[model samples]
Target: MITGIEHIAVLAKDSKALTDWYVKLFGFEIVYDNGKGTYFVKAADGSMLEIIACSGDCRPTEPKEWGIRHFALSVTEDGFDEMVEKLKVEKVEVVTDVAVSPKGIKTFFFRDIEGNIFHLIFRPTPL
Candidate 1:
């Protein structure tokens, strides 16, 4: 029934700000924005992360939810430091600073303006 992750939806209080943040931080371009509370962001790989505003009863999920804890993005080993520097320039909050895992991958965690945590990681080089 499931093939791969099509998109992840996030509830946004300020859709424009969220859209702009992704654009500025990771170079995500806006594929579509309805102006009524729904917007779609796409990366170079065609994966998308959507944001929709809630009104009366709609609510965003907490991190402890049973499904979809958070999203992870892979970066190149050489690009790891450059990526962190870019995030710093944008003034985004980095919850977990860069660190190397036992498996030899370099990783870091950061949150969007809306508090959605995302991980950026790079694979280790061959010995």
Candidate 2:
């Protein structure tokens, strides 16, 4: 049986910029970095996001990948606003405006510097 998400890995062209963006926007801290192609990030809930540099002919998904289309982060209301503001300050493109679900959760979508979409979702209470 599937337990849970192990980690979401992104092939980074500039891993340093990606790492810095995550740290500044989402409070992700570096758990490991070897000054090489690999780095690990630790979220507040202990989830991990790994960044690995890819070379030669490699490219990000082109809207036709088989699975794991995108990644989302659940944040508090305050965190959601804070992240949005930070992105705006940094001139990162916001692809989707904030929207509320029928279940009353708020979510907004944005892309990383490399065009990787990530969602910041606000869940007011337990599901």
Candidate 3:
């Protein structure tokens, strides 16, 4: 049977830069690096992301690309505001201000170093 997501993947023109960015900002540790421009970084909670460099002369994805638009990470309700402020202090580019969903979830959008979007969310109840 199907389970939850194992990992999310993104293409990078510079694997080392992207990997280091995740490690420095999100505290994700490098699980594996192929030494040929492919890396797997794992979060403290066990979630993983594959950061790979595409072959020859590839470019970063545009913000308005037609694929998966953004990835999300959740924070505890108590720590939500703190995390938001932390991102601001780190100078992450904010795409959207906090918005409340009908489900009472609050989320804000920001961009990673490579312009990939991320959502920081806080929910009143876990689904």
lDDT of each: 0.80, 0.81, 0.85
lDDT of 1 by residue, 40-108 (tens): 999888899898875565443455777655678778888889998888787767778899979889888
**TM-scores for the candidates:** 0.81, 0.85, 0.85
**Model 3, CA-based lDDT:** 0.85
Tens-digit lDDT track for model 3 on 1-127? Answer: 9777879988887779989988987778999999998999998779899998867766545568887889998777887788788889889999997888898899989988777889888889887
Candidate 1 segments exceeding 4 Å error = 56-67, 125-127
* Model 1 weakest 10-residue run by lDDT: 54-63
Against the true structure, candidate 1 reaches a TM-score of 0.81
Question: Number of clashing residue pairs in every model?
Answer: 0, 0, 0
Candidate 2: regions farther than 4 A off: 62-66
Error of 1 at 120 (Å): 0.8
Which 10 successive residues of model 2 have the least lDDT summed?
59-68
